[model samples]
Structures are given as C-alpha cells and as structure tokens.
Target: ASSRDGYSWTEKQGLKSGVPCIGTIQPPTNLDRASTEVFDVIVVGAGYCGLTAARDLTTSGILVADNPGSRLGLRTLLIEARDRIGGRSWSSDIDGYSFELGGTWIFWGQANVWREILRYQMQDELVSSYDFSKGLNKYILVNTERAQHFTHEEEDEMMESGLRKLVNVDGEYGKRVIPFPHTAAFTAEALRYDKMSVADRLSEIKDSLTPNELSGVEAFVLLCSGGTLETTSFFEFLHWWALSDYSYQGCIDYLVKYKFRGGQSSFAIRFFREALASGNLSYAFNSPVAEIDDTKDFVTVSTRDGKQYRAKRVISAIPLQVMNNVVFNPPLPSGKRTAASIGHVNQCVKVHAEVRNKDLRSYTGIARPENGLFYAFGDGTTPAGNTHIVAFGGQNGHFDPEDNIGTTARKLQGLVPMDIERLVFHNWSKDEFAKGAWFFSQPGLLSNHLGDMRARHGKVIFGSSDWALGWRSFIDGAIEEGTRAALTARTDLAPSQLKGKL
Candidate 1:
C-alpha cells in the first residue's frame, strides 16, 4: 500500500508506513536502518498505563490550562512490542468461558480505576465472583508441612491477627511508621522498616504464630511478593494495607473476588480504539525498544531492529524489570540502577485450568509447598462440563512455561488435588517485555529508590504500575500512573535537578 514508492518492501513483510509489524523480528535479516519518526511526545508500551497516558495526553484542554509553557497542539505516538495493546491485562477464553490470565479485579475502593469506570459508565460491565478463601477445601502448609482442612472462620481469625502483627511493627498500626501511605511523608518511618524484609517480621512475630500459622503467613507473603518473600520490603504490605483503608479483608477482596463482565482486554481495546479515533496517535507492534537516548533538546527511542523514533519527550510506560534490558545512552542514575538491579520481585505465572466438571465450586486461596503454583481457584464453568480455574505461581525459572497443559495440570493437582482436564496460561516472568509480574517492592526500594524511579529522566518520564502511589500492582495503578505521567510530562514539574545522568 505504498503509493509514493509504488511497490511495497517485497524484500520483507507488511511494510506499511507508520504501521508497525505485528510479528517477531529476527536480527541481521531485514531492517538495516532505524526509522526516526518525530512527535511531540512518544508513549512507550501499549498496556493499561500506556493506553491511559495516551488518552489523557490527547484530551484537549486537560493539561493546557494547568501547564503554563506546555504545548497545547501536541502530536504523539504510542509504541508497543507486541501485536496486542493490553500488556499484562490479557483475557483469554477456554471452551467459551472467560479467564483472566493477568490483572483480573477492580472495585470502588480503588479510586483511580473507579473514576475511569464511572467516567465511561462501565459500572454495568462489572461482575462479581466467589471468594477464594471461602472455598470448600483447604490445603495449608505448617513449617512447609501440608495440613488438614480448616474452616474459613478459623483461618480468617488467625490470618487477621498475624496480619495485624505484621503491620503493627511498633504496635501502633504504623502510626510512627507509614502514617501517610500516599506520599513521601512517611519516608523516615518507612525507611526504618524498609531495612527489614518480610522474613524479618515473620521471625519477630514467630512466637505468636503456630507452625501451621507461620507457614500459612509465609505462603501469603510469597503470594503477595509473587515469589520469595525473604528479600521483599515489609513496608510494601503496609502500603497495601493503607491503600486498602487499613483492612486486611479489603486487601483480599480487591485482589480477587470482583471482575469485569466482559474481558478487561476488551475494555482495553475500547480504550485503545477510542484513542486511535481521537488523537494523532500512530503505533507499531513487533517493535521492541532496545535503546533510549535523551539529548539536551530531543529524545530518540530505538527498537531492537535499529528503528528509531524521535520526540520532544518520551514516556516509558513499560515494566520496571524490563528497564534493565533497554540500554540508556547516559546510563541510568545509580539509585535507579540499584533498584533496577534488584528489580521487581513478583515474577508470578497466572494460569487458567479447566476440569471435567459441569458444576465445580468456585473458590481460591489454596497453597501447597510441593506444588509449584502459589494459588489456585475456580473461575467459571461451561455447559460442556468444563470448569475453568485460575492459578498463580510467583517463582520463575523453576519450570517450562511453554508446556501446554499436562505439566501445569499436574502442578495444580499437587496443590488443589483437582483433576484438570485442560490448562492454559501466559507466563509473565518469561515475557521479554515484562520480565516479572506486577511490582512487589524489594527491601529499601520504597524508601531509597521509589522517588528516583518516578522522577523524570531528562526528556523521559516514567509511567507504570511498578512505581504507582496506591494500587501498585493493579490495573488501577497502571492507568493512574500512565495518566499522571502524560499530564505531567507536558508541564514543568520542577523535577529535581538530576544530580548525575546515566
């Protein structure tokens, strides 16, 4: 479809101008030169955060009145590595049943995501599901030993008490620590706890907990951290508790239980479609950014294949872990490099398993040490006697993520003792663009590097759930972070004078 040149790039495939190829790119084969497209601002990553940032920045008069010297008539482009736009928020189907392999829940308590739902009148699209903790059977580990079934009421009390002790480090409900969860107000107090890992707290409160209780609590930490909890900061949980309005039950409720009527990916599509229809936005897939260079005036983003895009400013809405993959021309700041070196902890793999049952009880919160997966729960059932369940495993590089069904089914069986008929999943840990699951801050990150991570890097602004204020790991966090990054990128944010550039 090249009218100017007449013939297409027959040397390769899908050589449409401005339309990125929605496939893989092999090295030293096709593209030899980097394409430099100019824009006022170029948003990277097409996930929820990237999409939301693009949408808000495109809205006329939204940031114009607030930003004094900012350009009102701005041209922007969104770049994504994959063909799809949803990023981690993927909604797949098995035997015609809905299964969310990524970020799956949203509620009114998350004011950021709630506002979007209200703005788009998507309340009608909301659907509720059964709680995983209230499941019929229970399989918990006590000192890594599997235990018998316990009633929900009994488990709740033990967990609530244990959780209270975990956050009430000073027995003051974080009054002397993390008093303000929204900003750097509690930086000093937060740092005191930041030096301690989740395991450190578990050891301190070990006396109050039984062996079984301790194991359950440790597993919970693993699930929350997305893998090992030994090195994760204790303050991350406190931040989550504060975000959940100081209620442990609320934290559990928001993480699971609620869902979208249609798939969230569909919602993302609607958002992306609207963005395409409204803004001067153009995008390309199969284009993985490999390098970012910000000079005194303009910024250039380069893909792995040597394609480059130039812009006045760039918003990196990609995952925090993936930052290490991209070569920063001026090497990132030491603080960012330190945090990035440690990286996000949650490399959990979320899988959807189907069992041969017409009616299976939909529940979650099942963990067994032998089983590689950290959690499992029933999602939905099909008329064809297929019961869909979603499962998660935080530890990465432990097994083959490419194995289709049998391997994962066997792993889930060890945890829930279910007879899985078929299994389907997407391993976020294995994803090249997203090296890990949602952000689970490591010890000292919240105190030492979160501010540095969010601080604009010259012409680049960071926008991701990885460093969000409230819902750090949820879709709400991604959207809010993306929107804020875009809106702020247009303004003179009085960004701290970066002492040294990487």
Candidate 2:
C-alpha cells in the first residue's frame, strides 16, 4: 500500500485489494498514556499558532533529568483535527505538481514569518528559487473585458494617502489607532473606524476618485478584505495599513509578492520537526476537538471520539467560527461568545489550475463581483508546457472548487484567455476545520469584542491570526499569536508564577 512518497496514492493495486487508496482518516488511537492521560500543557489546532506555541512551551524548561539548569520542562501535547499541519497554509499536490491550496505567499514585511524562514535558512535567491513577484505583468478586468488596462499609479497614490488619513488620529499615523499593533486593542480612533464598514467609508471619498480609479481601488480592496466593503470593517484595513507603515505598496508586497520556494508546507514540516524535537510534545492527527471543559482547576479536552486529555494550560488555536461549535463548560467570555457567533467576513476562494498552453502571460484579470471572474494570474510554467495559474474569488458559494472549477476557468479564459486542462481547489469556507478564509472583521468587532476575546479565561488562552495585532488573518499573524500564547501558557504553568499570571 505504500507509494513512492507519503503524498502519492496508488489506485490500481489498492483496488485489487478491495481497500481504498485514499479517504478520510479515522480517530487516532494507541497514544502513550504519558501523552493522553495528562500533561502540563495541551494546545489544540496544531496549525501555525499551535505548533509555535507547543514548541516554545515544551522547550522553554529543562527536564529534571537533564541537569536541571532552568526550571522543569512543561510536558505538552499538540493535537489537530485535520490530517495534516499548516491549518490554513496548506501546501498540497495536484498531478505531481506542488500547489498551495491555501495561504500561499509571504514576504519580508511579515516579520514573524520572515524570522522563521531565517531560522530555518529556507531563503535562497541566487538561483531564482523564491518566486518573488518582481517582474509579473499587472492586468485588470475593465468593463467586463480582460482589457489589461488602467494603471495603478493613480490608484496607488489615492490608496496610500487615503489609508494614512484613515488611521491617522492626533495628527500622527498609528499613534491613536494602532500604537502596539501586535496586541491590538480598541483605541478611540480605532473604535471610530471600527464602527464604519469599508463601503461606508468609501461613500465619504467617492467624489475624490475618478470612475476608473474608483473601480480599480474597489476591486483591489475587495480582494484584500475577501468580501464586500459593507461586510468588512474599516478597522481591519486600517490595521493592515499601519502594519505596512501606511504605504499601499508595502501592503501589496506582503500580500502577494513573495512565496516559499518549496511551498508553505515545507515550512510547516520544518516547524513540526523543531516542535517534536523540543521534547514531550505529542500530536494526534485526524482528531477533532469537540469540547473543552474548564469547569475544574485542570482543563479536560474532549475529542469527537469522546476521548479526554487533561492539561494545566490549554491554547485554542482553531478558527473563530469553528471555535463557537466547541462547548465550553463555564462558557467563554461574552466578547468571545459574541464574536464567535458573528465569525469573520472573509470567504475568499483561492484556486490553482494548469493549462496545456505555452508562455501564458502573468497578469491579474479583475472584474466586479458577478459580471466576470474576480482575478486570475499565472504562477509559473510546468515542465509539460502547462502553465500553473492561481485565481481568487471574493463571494461565497459562487465558484465551488469541486463543482464550478470548469466554469471558473472558462470565465477567466474569456478575459485572460487560456487552454483549459485541469483544476484543483479546496473550498476553505465550506471546510469543517475552517469555516471561512482569513480574518476581516465585521462592523463593531474591533471595538466591541477583540479585546475581551483576546483575554485569557481561567487556564485557557485563545490565539488566532483572526485577531492578531499585526498581520491579521495571515500566517505571520498566526505565528505572532502562537508564539505569544505559548509564552503565556508557560508563564501560567510555571510553578514560580502559577497563581494565574499570563
């Protein structure tokens, strides 16, 4: 049943054996009692944040048998509901080609992720290994046509200035709105913007932009936020603007300009290796955490299979929307409860496709929501003369990856034009593990829920890129939150500081 590598599947032989070659996995079993019975810390969701938290939590202290230089090491267990790591940042395969079905790109602007890359020595630019968006042609859908016209100079100028004006309070950028962005809390200026949606703010600036400029900015921002401006809060974009130092160009650099040469999964694999090597970190795959009972002094985590694991400290790194489904014994704070009910607004669909064509120009085909395809661009050419392309959809249930990939290709072909071959995508919004894509808050979330939702409750600490102070909804933010949560858990579990500190 074993294939050439862990990823490939063999169908012919498995079919003869009357067993499936590929399918959904069953609940994990055979975990050592040391891992399942109890531990110092148990972190859920094994994604970027969970992995990072577990790594630091387990590695921070020295084992009693190992000279005991530092304090006693915290025994930790990290579990995931999915079969693989990298929660939203999954690097997968399609027809033997490396493809990123989710959270694809990263750049230097993302400090935390960049630090990980540097720590692992994964960056090598001498051979053109990293596909930095240095020379790709920019294209936009104009008037329902893949016209590839309309320059971003005017739009860029407008956006940079507008973003600065939006976040600037007390005549200074980020002074009032996002002073300490990594742990974003409500500020007077932040609350003012949090009350307004992107669409609402657009109304105030509509007269300042030309018609083409307006549409260009609108589509671009829509792609950025993953929903209509009406559903996305201005606070989200304002925070991003501040993260990018109030420059439109810096924001774009982190959003799409850079990518890992081997794929984001490579980073995840490397991260897991470090975490596992840190010691006493056990992980369970194909395990969905259903309930977290913090009723007693110790936290008991229950999986869908009814198995329970106890820990002194717990970090819930799952998606906000999915987190609502998990029953909490004492119940979550009103802020987390209210925010979980509302969830995030982002439902963007990202798809990767290959076409039997040559020299397909790399360009972004932009269109309004329903009139045409949202955006399309070529990733690179495969050895078989097929061009690897990636596309994004802002609306929900409109372009299902399984049922409507063909239609999506045709729509995009009409604008950018390409010979269709094959397509692959995972509907993240429909995915059980992650109910939606990245984080874009609805109106009032920043002012009403973010601060309280971020606070720790009893022995449980919540961490997600959804509310990260910087790089919200991104892998960078995930790392920031995970690293912070791990540190918080360590402090709370440490004997010297155990009186509910953190």
Candidate 3:
C-alpha cells in the first residue's frame, strides 16, 4: 500500500484521525438562527447516547399543557466535538476496505443494540468473523518464553478450566459474587469481591493453575480491561462472566463473534437520520463544549468557540475520562468528580492491518501483556485478497504504532507472522474527546461511586455509556443510557410544562 492508498510510512504523516463519511450530515435547521432560541433539550456529544436521547425527545409528541390538548414536539440540539456521529464507535474506509476504528462487535446478548438492529432491519447485515461451527483454524498463545500453538480442543479445555477457577471465588463460578449482573445491587459478599483487583484474584488462584492456563487467564484479562491486572476490578470481570451465563465460550461469543455487514457507522447513521426526520432536532458539528452552567432557570452550554446555547434540560453524553476537561457551574457531585479524576483503567491501542496472508483468515493470536502485541484475530479478507486483522496492545507496552509504521508491522509479525502491507488505527488514549478506548471500572468505582455517577446534577442528566447499568462501555449500554435519559427528561418536564413551571 502507498500514500495514495491512505497508508503512510508514519502515522503522523498519513493516518487520518477519522475518515469522511455520510454520518457527518448537516442538520437542516440553521444553527446561526437557532442560537437565539432556547431549545426544550440540548444533548451534548452527539454520540450514540446523545443521539438516542435527542431522537426520543424530539419524536415523542409531548403535549404543550399550556395550550391544552395540543401536542408539540420538543426542540432538541445535538452538539458534537468531532465532525462525525459515532463517538468511539467509528468506521473508517482505507483504500477499498472498511476498518472499524473503534468499537466493532455486537451480539444478541446485548439487548439494546440488538433492538436497534431489529428496528433498523439490519439483521440480514450481520456477519461473523469466522464460522463458529468450524472454530478457529489456529490458536497461538505468546509468552516471553515462546509462542505455543494448541489444538482447538486443547485451547478450549485449558481456557475453560483456568477461567472457571479464576472466577469461582465462592465455588459457584461468579454467580454468588454477582447474582444480579445488570443491576447495581451489591451484597456484602459482592462488596468483598469488589475490593479485589484482577491481579489480586489472579494471585489467589495462580498456584492452582498450570502455566498455559495462567497465561490464558492473563491474556483474557488484558484484552477486556485493556489495562494491567493491578488496576482492573475483579468484580467488574465477574459481572461480565455472570452476564455471559458463567461460561468462557459464551463470553467469547458475546464479546467478539458478530459485527454488522458494513460497519457500526451504518447503525449510528440510522439514529442520526431518524432524529433529523423528527423535524424538531437541530445539530452543530465540530462543537466542543467548554463549560456547562445549570442556573436553576435553565442550562447554558458554552462551547470553546465562545458560543452559548440554552436548553430547559441537558444530557451530557461525554465519556467518563474526558469529563474533567469541561468545567461545571455548580461543580459536579463529589463522587462523580472523584470517579472522573480517577478515571477508568483502560488506556490501550487497537490497530487494524492488512496482511498478504490469505491462510490466516481463521487464526486467533493471544500474547502476554508484556509483549508488543496483546491480542489479535483475523477479521476477514480485503478486496485485494489480503487478510484483514485487528490487533490490540496495552499502553506503555513495547509497541508504539505512532512512532514508526515499519516497526509496528514488524512487531505485529512477531505475534503472527504475516506479510504486512498497510495499517490503520486511531489512538483513543490520546484523543481529547475520548481519552481512553472503553470503560473498565477500577477497584473502588462500583462500590463507592456508581450511584453518584448515574445521578443528575440539577437539570443536567448523566447519560453516557461509561455508567450504563447493563452493558457499560458497549454500544448497547450507550443506547440504554440514551433512551433512559430521554424518557427521564420527558417525564420530569411534562408535569412542569403542565404547571407552567418550565
């Protein structure tokens, strides 16, 4: 691949942060004129969460009680920092292939995203990374010592045994620790588990597991947390286990098996289109919020460009780690401030590469966190018949994609030998808007700060994927929080409008 093909010798020289796409549509309403008017709702950060909230509010015919029996749509404004729609879930086109630069996979187990797939009639667009019936063609586990290949049966047996032992703290395979995975309900027993980090738990079971089994557990932890085991909460991992029906195979399927035919951008554009069709939704792209002031009367959101917008209610869909950048009028709740300051423990990198190796179409690679490459898998084949692979590595690791393209390719080859051609990626950790890849709660986040993170401050609602109850940090969670925040705003404002208080 050449520079003309969107591949450069260095990322700083040629890698585009986010590609141009149809999702960056201009809302029909003119923002210059709308600035003088107060909207019924202003949704900040036009990610999936904000998009869903704005869509619901603008579409629902909430009655203007002052005019009695007359239904009027709520005026909503969606402000985005980037020119595109999907927040961390973006799809970029490099040459003739589609590379999901951010969040990629989806499954039926993720209820909210699944509903949107059905609603948008995209069920036929679903595709698997590989045929599950045939299983993985190759399984290689890389450690400092060597790279060992295992048969499908051998890998499954070791993975199941190691993972089961890791989470079976109470001898019930995480069920007793997290009986209710979707809820914030934490028993005293659960709190005890919450206090332990992944590293701590691993140490508790390290003696009982074999070396290969231990490495399997380590690879999975590094993949999910994206951070080292010392900081990731054990309870957070347990919650995923319980949600996946307490089976290693189920977790694998739920996490990385299925993806949309085109990309997540297609799914996100559907929400954007629906919101615009409502006739009440207006939007401003390239608007980064600087400050949020809740003045008891209404909320005034000030962008960095010195423009102010007013709204009766505001839903802030900013990512958890990026929240510290914007100043709040009456400072955010103490717990929320603490959580934001501490941040999620997911500082990782995801890189997509095209390799001239058709034989690796069904290969899966996992390496120790200390290695340059932590995990990788064959996604599919490109138009040129090259294998498309997505690889992830932890921050501060040996691999630095931005440093040099040739070095990055060579490092990837160390994990899985392939004739590398081109690579595409986005450094989410360095992104001002994202600050991190995905949310992986730290040790004290759940037990000490979850309720406050979900609570609202005055008229500002916390509707981000970071604190979603069900599938936090996933596309499904973004939709769940977005839908809930919209309904909450409607429920509260309806009565006030009837009483003429708004």
Candidate 4:
C-alpha cells in the first residue's frame, strides 16, 4: 500500500533467481524479544515523542543493566505500527524529488523543543524559506474571474486583526473565559473563541473586508486549520494563534525560518538510525498494540500478534483516538477513557504534485466556496526542472486524487505557468496506523476532558503533540511532552528519601 523510493512497482528478480544479497538474511522470529531480559522503560510508538524519550532516557547517567546502578542506564523499547520509523512525519522520493507526505515545517521561535533539533545539528539539512518580510506574492481563487493578488501589507493586517480578536474579547486581552475545569488566563482566552467556528467568526468581520480580502481570509482559515470554520473549533484556532505568537505576522515569520531543509522525514530516519546504533532499543514494526496490563508492579504490553513485553514503566505515545482500542486491564478512569472516545480532528488528505514550471516560487493559499482545499503552496524543487506543489484537505470533505487533480492543477495553472506531470496523495483516514493528521479539541470537549486525558495511569505516562498545552500539533510540542514525561518517569523511579520503617 506504501510507495518506496517512488514509482508504483519494482521487480524482485533476486528472489526468483535464488541470488542472495550481502548481509541479507531471514529476520529472526524472536526479533521482538530484547537481547536482554527486561527494560527500564517500554515506549510504545516510534514517533517524535517516543524516540526523543528513549534517546534522552538512555543517554542520561542512568545505568540500565541486570541490576540497576546509581544512575539507571535506561533500557528503552520503541514499537511502531508502520514498517517505517516515523509515525506521522514521513518523506519519500517521488519523481526524483524529496516530498514530505506528513508533517513538515518548524518555526524558528519554537524555543524549547525545536532548539534541540538545532543543538543536535539538524538545521543545515532543513532549509528555511525566503524572507517573509519581503512579502511573498499571494493569489486567491474566488471562483473563475475573481482571482486577485494580495499585497504584503494587506495580508499582514488581516493576520494581525485575526490574532487581536483571538486574544482580546469583551475589552479583555489574554483573559480566561472558561473557569469550570481549570482556572487559567489562557483558558479564558481559549473560551472566547470556543463558541464560534472559524467561519462564524469571519462572518462578523465580513462588512469590514473587501471582496478579495474576504476571500483571502476565508482561504487562510481553511488552509491553516485544515478544515472550514464550520468544522474547525474557535478554541483550536486560538491555540494555534497563541503557539505562533498571537499574530499571523509572527506565524509566517516562524514558518519562513523554521522548516526541515532535507524534510522532517530526514530527522525521523536519523533518530531511528541513532536508536538502533545505541543497541539498547528494540522495536516491533507492523505490530499493532492490542492490550496493556498495569495491574501488576511491572506493566505488560500485548500486541495483536499475542506477543507480550513487560517493563517497569510504559509510555503510550499513540494518538488519543487509537488508544481507546487498546484494552487496559484495570480499565482507564472515566475521564481518560472519555477523552480517548472523543477522538481526534477529522480525516485529512494531502496531495503533492510535480509540475513543469520553475517560476512559481511563492506559497499560494486558495479559498473556494465549493471546495476549500485548506492550503496549497509550492513546496520543493522537482527533478524535472520544475516546482513541487502540495495541498492539504482537511475533514470538511473528501476529494478524489484522480478526479480532482486536474481541477487543482488548472486552478494553479491560472496563477502560475506549469504543466502537471503526476500527482501524489495520502489519505490519512485510510491509514490504520493513524486515523487522522492531528488531534483537536471539539466543542465542550476540552473543558470536560483535557486534564484527566493527560493524567498518568499508574506507571504508564501518555505524551504526544495532542496532549500538549501549547503547540499541540507541532513537533515542538511533541518534544516538550517527551521531555516532561521522561522527567516524570525519572522522578517516580527515584529512591525514597525516607526509606526506614517507622
């Protein structure tokens, strides 16, 4: 079902000819079993959170051996449902060009987690875009004849206005509107937008916007949220706004400076290779975890294959929605269980196309009434001496890759000269490993479940971008959660100061 190294099919002549490649042999059946008997930590999921957790825990002065030492060397296990290492972050070669299929782009201002990527020396491979201040040309397709260009100042004003509204409501800036679940300033800020959809919010400002301005704003909402205002939560929009400094200007500035030069997948691959080299990490691929038993002192994890792994501590980095399917022996608390049942954002499908054109350098955001394809922009350089463009369609509706590829291309064709060669699309809905791109707080759901959903269950800790308070859907959030969870685990395992019995 997955394409490797591009192209639809490749010949496997070696198997038929009975010729063996060097160092190629049958994988051991006991591969899932660690070379050692037990591990200090068993991390389920090999995504950013899981990998970073394993790496940090292992390298710390902790001694991980038959007998625990002064600083426990962390023995970690990472399990992935897919054949590849990256959970949602993935990249592959298509038409001789590197294309990111999942999450891409990192903002420079994302201090804590993103700084790790730079400290680890990954920035060179991940390129930043052209200057955002120069005001990259933007075009909007308001039906056929309505296509118009937006000036940089116009775009900046629109973004600033949106952010200003998000943070300020009823003459209050950065105030908490909701107080039931938790009393916090951001919560109030989040509550102001909670009742309205992105579309509904925009309608209030329609009178102030020109025809082109309205269309551009509509497109920006759809593209950024990955769904129409009708489907996207106002709180979620505010959350993103907060993550990007409460301004569209800040968001674009971060986007232009923060991105994977070689693509996010490169970081994933490097992490995987590094984990393997550590010789302390073992993994089970294509194996979906079915159950987790935390009744005993040690946590036991059972995969669909019926194989079990027992460890002192467990980390569930899987998306909240998927976690509901895995049975927990003691049964998760009502709140945590309810949070999982609430599920993630709607299904998302991303399309990448390589066209015969180089002049198309700027990113394009289009908002169409009939079809709001979230966001589409020129992504990378193609092998065919052209530009690679990508589109993100969120849960609002579905678009057939084959049927709509022509239409999407034509829309872009009007803006820039290009001959579409081939198209690549990934339906995350159809993907068993990931049911959706990212998690979203539905109306009335965050108030009811955000806290309990993040609470730890016994020795098991849950960490993912979805559970993060800030930058919920970004890699920075994932790393922040990973670091936080690791610290929690480390603290819990520390020896009690008052060991003697009274």
Question: Which of 2 and 3 is the better model by TM-score?
Answer: 3
> Candidate 3 lDDT, tens digit per residue, 245-340?
899998888888889768888899898888889788888877899999997698999999998999999999999898989999999988889999
Give the higher-TM-score candidate: 1 or 4: 1
Which ranges in model 2 have alpha carbons more than 4 Å from their true place? Answer: 1-30, 33-36, 62-72, 125-138, 145-186, 369-372, 496-502
Query: What does candidate 2's lDDT look like per residue over 15-44, in tens digits?
Result: 111111121123333267554467778889
Provide backbone clash counts, one per model. 4, 1, 0, 16
Each candidate's TM vs. the true structure? 0.84, 0.85, 0.93, 0.83
Summing lDDT over every window of 10 consecutive residues in candidate 3, give the lowest-scoring window: 1-10
Q: Which candidate should be chosen as best, given lDDT against the real structure?
A: 3
Give per-residue lDDT, candidate 3, residue 331.
93
lDDT by residue for model 1 (1-502), tens: 1001011111124222221211121231222246455677788898899988887766533333444444333567788887667787866543355556577888888888888888778888876665343235443332244546665566677777777777777677665576676676566767887778888888888898876566566667777788576767888877777777666687667777678766676577666666666655667666889999986567888888777878878999988888888888777888888878888778787766666643345444556564677665666665566666677777632554455344655666656566655555565766787877788987877777888888888778889988888788789889889878877765632232121321
* Alpha-carbon lDDT of model 4: 0.62
Residue-level lDDT for 187 in candidate 4: 56
lDDT per residue (tens digit) for residues 206-261 in model 4: 66766555655665655555555676776766566555565577667654345565
The Cα error of candidate 3 at residue 84, in Å, is 0.7
Q: lDDT of all the models against the reference? A: 0.68, 0.69, 0.81, 0.62
Q: Which sections of candidate 4 miss by over 4 Å?
A: 1-36, 63-68, 130-138, 151-154, 157-189, 255-257, 372-374, 400-417, 496-502
- RMSD in Å for all candidates: 8.1, 5.3, 3.2, 5.7
Give residue 488's error in model 1 in angstroms. 1.8
